[model samples]
Target: MTRLAYSALSSYSRVQIMRLVQDHPGRTITDLCDETGLHANTVREHVQRLIEGGYLVAETERRTTRGRPRVLYSAATGEAAASSPIARRKAEEAARRGDLMRRVLPWTADAELPSDALHQIDALVEDLGDAGFDPIIDEGALTVDLSPCPHASADGSHRDVLCAVHQGLMEGVLTQAGGPLRIAQITTSCDPSTCVVMLRR
Candidate 1:
């Protein structure tokens, strides 16, 4: 941990909140409150301190519905990855990959492909690769192996939390891409070593 990171995470609540943000970035204040079991006022106070100290940064997301835009907070710690050029490159690649998936999924869903099996599998490979899952697809594309996970170490509560988030991201992409298709679940299983996502047509 950097001096700044250590200094900022000194408090128990701050550390808890920071860890939560690290696992789930772009979380709103209400999301943080629900996840951390912290009151909104208390979360806001701590979030303000984190922002001033450069441990976190806030972003304004455009509202999809008729309401005010929401503010999302993410970790801004200048840790090892933040300082390294290689790490930044990976992050950039991951962002582009994710964006591509977001763009392609809806279109894929709209394409009305004859082989949903093949097309969907192709999309998953591209999507997971761009997200830095380091994906390995078996011969039939029936099984996938994601080694060197996008996450550091999946342990404790985080193991389940991160896996669920990953699953949700993929599922969300599918839902957004395919308007009327209501296949809500993606079969995803993972351990600290690897994550395996099974695709069914």
Candidate 2:
């Protein structure tokens, strides 16, 4: 993760917004304000920060008639190349980090694991590390075990939100990494000691 993205997600409010948008795309600022109980200006600021960090994408809402179209925000799923210069730079940095991490990390010498899978794993591991997941990868099972989740202290609804945001983050990273690998499921336990993320082609 780039510094900007790290900073953007550091705010709990922003993570909530990300989780909301990821769950329901094309949400307007007013919608976010109502759901989050944040002032419209505050919601707009958070949304803009998410956009600048490349965690969210913004679009002009389509309208048949009437006043100006509302601006909608949704999680960035890496469907398209980075649109802004800041986002582009962050992406380049992430790619560089992924390459460097792959080089320093141990790998299965046997050709059992394809290069594409390795690339995807590298990206996922890098992002998880940045987010303080301390991931342990099992190449054989194609699963990642995340221990001591940073937000493990959160309970109930907050826990659900954290899990959703984390899952979305992984999905975005995997998509951007550009490989056949994808997240099949993420099993999060009430006991924050460990959360297993299963991946598949």
Highest-scoring model, TM-score: 2
| Ten residues in sequence with the least summed lDDT for candidate 1 | 80-89
Query: What TM-score, computed on C-alpha atoms, does each candidate reach?
Result: 0.41, 0.83
lDDT of 2 by residue, 1-201 (tens): 235554677778998999898889888998999999999999989988888777788888789999998888878887773233444445456566656765787453325767656777776776677676689888888889987677777666777777888798788877776778889998877587668999998
Each model's backbone clash number: 1, 0
Candidate 1: where is the Cα deviation over 4 Å?
Answer: 1-28, 37-119, 139-141, 179-191
lDDT of 1 by residue, 77-180 (tens): 33432122322333344445545664878543323333333344454454465455677765244566776576645346665555554564454333323322
User: Alpha-carbon error at 158 in model 1, in Å?
Assistant: 0.8
Best by lDDT: 2
Clashing pairs in 2: none
Weakest lDDT window of 10 consecutive positions for candidate 2: 81-90
